[model samples]
Target: MPTPGSTQRKFRLADDALWAEYDQACRDINGSTDRSDDIRKHVEAVVAEWKQRHKMN
Candidate 1:
């Protein structure tokens, strides 16, 4: 679990291409604002969807 504002320090991307794509997606969705927050929200949505699909939560 990560506390608020700790995401940037905790999450890391090893692949430059993946990071670039993620950054571009974030910018496309958020218009160059709150990229980190958008990424966090995107990750949370994916997790939530996965959990719901798996009936884990």
Candidate 2:
């Protein structure tokens, strides 16, 4: 998966309510408490789809 040596990243939410909503959505889709890997996978999927649709490499 991704060569196994990826750099960690940090992101800030708009506010506490937004952060809570995002966290709950992740948890709901994951069906478990742990979201460490799910978040990355979801973000990657979103970025890939966006780039493909926009013809951006």
The TM-scores of all predictions, comma-separated, are 0.48, 0.49
For 1-57, candidate 2 gives per-residue lDDT tens digits of 344788767666669987677678878987764556777788999999999989964
Candidate 1 backbone collisions, by pair: none
Return the clash pairs for model 2, or none.
none
Worst 10 residues of 2 by lDDT: 1-10
The clash number for model 2 is 0
lDDT of 1: 0.76
Backbone atom clashes (below 3 Å) for every candidate: 0, 0
- Candidate 1 lDDT over residue span 1-57, tens digit each: 457876435666799998888778778877885666876687999998998989963
- RMSD to native for every prediction? 4.8, 4.7
| Residue 12, candidate 1: alpha-carbon lDDT | 67
Residue 32 of model 2, lDDT score = 64
